[model samples]
Target: MRLAPLDGGEDAETKPLWQRLGWMVAIWLVSVTALGAVAYLLRLWLA
Candidate 1:
């Protein structure tokens, strides 16, 4: 598959609302979990 450059933001209105929200929530959860892991490791290293 040929990869193309981002063509700006895709129109949100074109996608189903549930699909967009699901992606948002999934990404948010992943980011939060990664941050928590980093904080935990730092705390352990500093103790």
Candidate 2:
């Protein structure tokens, strides 16, 4: 016997606007942190 999953593979558009904004903010935060770490390391090595 097979059971269907809830929401059934819905499209991203179905998510509320706030949820999308949350994901964008999280990704941007991660990117900024990574860049800052890289810049700091380079400055330390070059100095």
Provide the overall lDDT of each model, using Cα atoms, as 2-decimal numbers.
0.88, 0.89
Tens digit of lDDT per residue, candidate 2, span 1-47? 64567445576768998998999999999999999999999999999
Residue lDDT tens for model 1, 1-47: 63455443467668999999999999999999999999999999999
- Model 2 sits at a Cα RMSD from the real structure of 4.2
| The 10-residue segment with the lowest total lDDT in model 1 | 1-10
TM-score for all models, in order of appearance: 0.72, 0.75
**What TM-score does prediction 1 earn?**
0.72
The Cα error of candidate 2 at residue 40, in Å, is 0.4
